[model samples]
Target: MPLIVFCGIPGSGKTTRALQIKEYLEQKHKCQVVHLNEEILQMEKKEVYKDFQAEKFARGFLRSNVEKNIAGNTVVILDSLNYIKGYRYELFCLARAAQTQHCVIYCECDPQLAKENNSKNANNFTEEMLADYNNRLEIPIPKNRWDSPLFHLRSKEETPFEEIANVLLYQAKKSKDPVSTAPEIKFEINFLQELDLRVQSVIDELVQKQQESIQSNVITFSDCTEKLMINKQISLIELKKIKQEYLKITKHNPPKRIEDIKNFFIIYLQKVVERF
Candidate 1:
């Protein structure tokens, strides 16, 4: 079973769709469904959304649960306000690292309807948060690989239950034969130096190509699967900065295979580059 995340404004039927999918999987498919949310987490939604520290703790808690329950025969449905695009990317990476499938189910509705629904329920949530919903939202775009396999369920529309099951279940089962090392990566002290050197070489090559093409807007790594699309002017200094940040992110957790240094770095570069 794969990880299915729900995202939308408050009262946008995220919880509703999550429960529906959970029931659908359990009854229709006879699979164990882990419905992870505030109730299961034993945390108040108000507390989780009240401030930064609280939200961080809550997100970390849910993330841990998702990581643990992502595997096995359980279908993990995370019911939350996953309005943060970066957070969704983190989920995507987790899925990639796990060698599992993941999808985003975005519940859409009129903001006014959402606000009114939230108020009527008034489940310990403040009225002030309603207005911030749209501002806080980082809408998911399907073209973004991280946000791919996305589903949009507006009010009154039935969720694509079979389609959802097909992607996470049938497709996943079809490709489960490969050995997955993402959960158990190992490396040595010398490996760290090699990783640093490998990343720097990639930077050197990219900068060289940039200069060779007289600073072409687009640069491609023929050896790597990742694609880097420049939306604006990029410089050597900026490329170095991106490399450093990428290293920092992977410092404690390098690529699953040492040989994949270039591929992993290029993938990360595209992600960071696209943000600009």
Candidate 2:
């Protein structure tokens, strides 16, 4: 449950450091590392970096992948120019919600040298783009909880593999041990029961609405076909199982708002229904 984020300019050796960390974690710790660099490279091959919207889409895609991967006991390394503080905050929220540990590695580099390095690379950014990115970069501060445990490294500095490994591995072990003040499992029984009821209620309402639409002859044949597909895919037992799985997932990271809870139930139901 370790998320290592790399933050730096394009030519700041962020990728190199990420690779070094990935190698060390895999070799020394025998840990699986999900490198976002490969994903970014795939996106680059698709030219997803050409447009701002595409870049945002790529980030969201990568974030979802990270979220899914972090559900298990693997290490995630996000190798990118994580320049936006808000984006980093979003990542922090994801890590917190998933009960994972995360830290940022900032690769500090001189502008002139960075530009010179960029000039030597084939996939180099234009001087104008690099300047724009630099202007837009929001450096992570230690005062922010999300940016705590921040590790700083100069462009030419050797990667401190052992130090980082110890911090992540040992801290993860400490966190895994249950806290003395942890709430009693029985205390959450009532909340889980209520959540289960709410999930069932939402599914019941959706089925009723679909039946009403079909009986009222308001839906076309194609719509009926789609409804039938969903109905055939989501059996009552399967729906109940899905609800149970959702409850288990949310037990640790429950939705905070009433609307969010309802929305979560509906969205999860839709996802499960669509899978078939």
Best by lDDT: 1
**In candidate 2, which residue pairs clash?**
none
Runs with alpha carbons beyond 4 Å of true place in candidate 2: 38-41, 45-47, 177-276
lDDT of 1: 0.77
Per-model TM-score on C-alpha atoms: 0.68, 0.63
lDDT tens digits, residue span 170-252, model 1: 88777555564333445686888888888887788777776676555666775665545564656988988988877776764
Q: Return the top candidate by TM-score.
A: 1
lDDT per prediction? 0.77, 0.70
TM-score of 1: 0.68
